[model samples]
Target: MDNLTHSLVGALIGQTGLKRKTGLNIPALIIGANLPDVDAACFFWLEGVEHLGFRRGITHGPPAWLLLPLVLAGMLWGFDRWQAKRGKRPEGRVPVHFGWLYLLGFIACLTHPALDWLNVYGIRLLEPFSSQWFYGDTLFIIDVWLWGLMGFATWWSLRQEKRGETWRKTGRQALALALVYIGVNGAISTYVASSAQAANPQATQVIASPLPVTSWDREVLLKVDYGYWAHVESSARQDLARPNKISVSPCRLSTATAGANSQLDAFLFWSRALIAERAEDGSVILRDARFYDPRARDRFSLALPDVECEPLAPPSP
Candidate 1:
């Protein structure tokens, strides 16, 4: 999920009466919600597709979940003391409770991974312990509907707060609605996956990727022996009658070249449904079936240069 969604979720959580727990409870919630994304810094040091292999890994795992909130609590405690020393602490602020801060931080931080897991981009829930990627295939990476739902609720809650009216109820309602929306989408994905599998028994894997604008629409990708099959499906239509075949001969690189190119290796490690094709220039163009876009050629693609490409035989039908 996008950082905006994460921040909004954190704020919503705070608005549900958790902000009253401590002086910096809101800040802790908001910051902790985005803390797992600190791994994004890998972009500065890692080039090309290397960040893909590193991101949503160790940071989104159990160890960081346990330790990050503690670190945040300590920082908030230090900041509170610093403010007191400078006599700049807010006069109306509630007493800062370290325990409450840690607990709130933990709660907010947990939402980050949970939301992240709902998209096809995938998350490493048990990273470091296991490098396996998990996908929810429920929602788009950035859903306008979610933005509207949570955004309105958060804004309305704050408005109610300013007017000294009941505010927590709005947040709670929004949270419930969001969960219901997620559940509906999950069911849709599950149905689509089952339909695809039933339609094509040869499919080894299937992904029901949610579209950006239409909540009911999904771009389904199925991995088969030859290559992949892709098509759009909606809640109104569950049939997989015809799908565009993305047929490409598998290009295998020599062990030496594969091990030497860090960028190629990283892309291979991250790509769940990988497809390799030999370009006209003899370079190997690597792509993932889930994110490949023909119009935008370079987005989710990596080209390996000066590598010997051997086209493998397609599996017998």
Candidate 2:
């Protein structure tokens, strides 16, 4: 989910009876939502040091979350102590059920990677012990559907509850909707994996994802790069991988243009290093260029805002 969605979720979660304070639970939700990205900090480009996928290491690992509760509890305790000394109570302290509050933070933080894994991108769920990346290729990084379904539902439900409506009713309905989305996408991913296997039973196959765009809608891409030449299945409604894969090895975003052969080269210039790729036939392939994709291409792949193109160099004179 994007920052806005995250903020909204935090706010909604704040409305819980568990959160008696005005601002305490909201901050927890926000922190929990973003806590996973902390791994990005480890990606320090240096003059002497080499490059490494920081998140695929400790940050995305299962064991790394083991300390999440302890860290959160300590922070809350320190805050409570500070408030006592000042004789001015803090605005957002979880007065009761410290254990449950800490637990929620841990789960919120964990959700980041769990959702991240659903996308075609790589994540190291079990790090230190292994560096092999596992990608569910489940959903798009910043899908609007997830925002509306989870964050939006949470907000509306909370709002209704505030006005003496039934929070339980709305929350249950929201949960059911969310589960359906997850289940449908999960089934879709399996179908994609099967399609890849049928393509080359002799080869070892690994399925990537069906990035969620809405409650039950998603964009799925399957990459068969493990064997000889790499191929991709950029399917919408469960299309299979074709033999002829787009061979834009080490491509750049600057190459995106209609009827151009610089397909591979153009994607490289974009934030491929920071996002997922959804390749379509030579026609186009969409990626989550959050830091660079100005139009939020996730909205509509072909709707990306135009950027001035540098002419491909003329043939040698």
Candidate 3:
């Protein structure tokens, strides 16, 4: 999920009665929520698809989940002390406690991966221990509906806080509602994927990715023996059994274990539904069917000259 969503979730978590636990509660929540994204710094040194392989890895792993919050909490605790020493601390700021700060950070950090897992872009929950990727495929990376829900809830809770009314329950209710929304979406994803599998009995794998702006519409990708199949199916459509459009392409998986370049290697590594084609000049062109777009050709693709391309017949005049 995007940082905004992460930050909002952190804020909501803090407002759910955690903020009163520590002086730097909000900081711990918000910072911890986005802490796993420290892996994004890989982009600074790594180039292109290298980021893909490095990101959502170590930082999002089980060990990091346990330790990153401690790091963030320590920093926040130090910052507060430094502010006090410099006499720049706010007058209304409450005394900070290390334990409460760590707890808040931990709670916020935990939510980061959970929300990330809900999206199509996979997360490495067991990163250092295992490089396996897990996908919920329940929601889009950035769901406007979620933004609205979290935004409205945060705003309303703040208003209640200012009015000196009990606002903790408001935040709790918002979190409950958000959980319900995610649960419903998860069920829908499972239904859509099952329906697609039923339609294509030969499909080895069925990935049902939720489409933005639709509650029950999904772009289903199926890996068949021949190549791959893609279609857009909607549960709300009159014909739930039929997909809106079905596109099938025939190609073989690349024999090369590694890509010609880091970019291609990273893309291939991250791609779940990979498609490959033999180019005319004995090059291998690879694409991830998940991001397949005819109009925006080669957007999520890489060309490898070193990888052998299957022989093709010459065109007759």
Candidate 4:
């Protein structure tokens, strides 16, 4: 999820907690919740250092979670002590019930990684030790539904609270809607993925990509069981057009197909099922199709020669 989405969720949780109980340090809690994303700052100031490699490393690892409570506690102590020394009411021990602050921070930061996982670029949540990249391939990196839910919840809660309305009415309703949307989105993604997989049981590696294409209904990423062959493609199946064009791998399947069966047939099946335009070269092209730009093939050539430019031209029509 994006910053605004994270912030809205954090604020909503904060508001709900405050509404239910007394003594939460809402501001500090909210700040701590968003601290993990401080990594985003590196993208601008640190350049290649930020997300280029370290996006979901130690910061998102399981071990880092243990230190959060301690870190929050120490931060709380220091801030209060400073306030007291300055002759002010030291924010008074931050309502003990607010210790749930740890959970708040955890969930908030967790959302960051979870959302990133939805993107094509993988997130190494279990880094160093386990660099195996994992992707949800479910939701889009930033969903408009998430944004609207979080924003509406925060707004509705604040406004209703101002009018002395019940928090349960506005706040809970918003959270419920968000959860429902996530659920529905997840179910649809899973069904599509399962269908792609069943379409080709022999595929060595299957990457189901619903994003990175336009007007294009589905894009499936596949790795065949043959010659280390792979592909990133999109294809079409239309209701009105009988026997419309489709491929085992279609987005860039411009490659001639005489020897198409050379690559593992399994991966090729999914590729053809999902492809629209085969690559000019039969080789797999690993590139982000997010922009759906008509000229993406040309652009991909610049960065991914191995996957994009290698010409394993399909044998023949």
RMSD of each: 2.2, 9.8, 3.6, 8.3
lDDT ranking of the models: 1, 3, 4, 2
Which candidate has the top score in TM-score?
1
The clash count of every prediction, one per candidate, is 0, 26, 0, 29
> For residues 1-317, could you state the per-residue lDDT of candidate 2 as single tens digits?
35565554444444444345322455565676566666656536421111223444576677767675557656765676777789887554436345655766676666666666666546767777876666665566666876677676777777787788866566556656765776777777677667666765543444444444442433322233321223343555444544443333222334345334233223332222222232332223444322223455433233223333232222221
Highest-scoring model, lDDT: 1
For each candidate, what TM-score against the reference? 0.93, 0.64, 0.91, 0.65
Model 3 per-residue lDDT tens digits across residues 29-108 = 99999999998878689865567667788888889888999999899999999999999999998889999999888888
Give the Cα-based TM-score of candidate 4 against the true structure: 0.65
lDDT of 2 at 162: 70
Q: Mind giving the per-residue lDDT tens digits that candidate 1 earns over 1-317? A: 99999999999998888898789988899999999999998988998788878899999999999999999999999999999999999998889999999999999999999999999989999988998999999999999999999999999999999999999999999999999999999999899878877887878888888988897788878776655445545535656745556666566556676667788778878888787778887778888888777864576788877676888666545
lDDT of 4 by residue, 172-265 (tens): 6776787776666556566655665676565555555555323123455544443232334443442211111123343343345323332223
Q: Report lDDT (Cα) of residue 28, candidate 2.
A: 61
- Each model's C-alpha lDDT? 0.86, 0.51, 0.80, 0.51
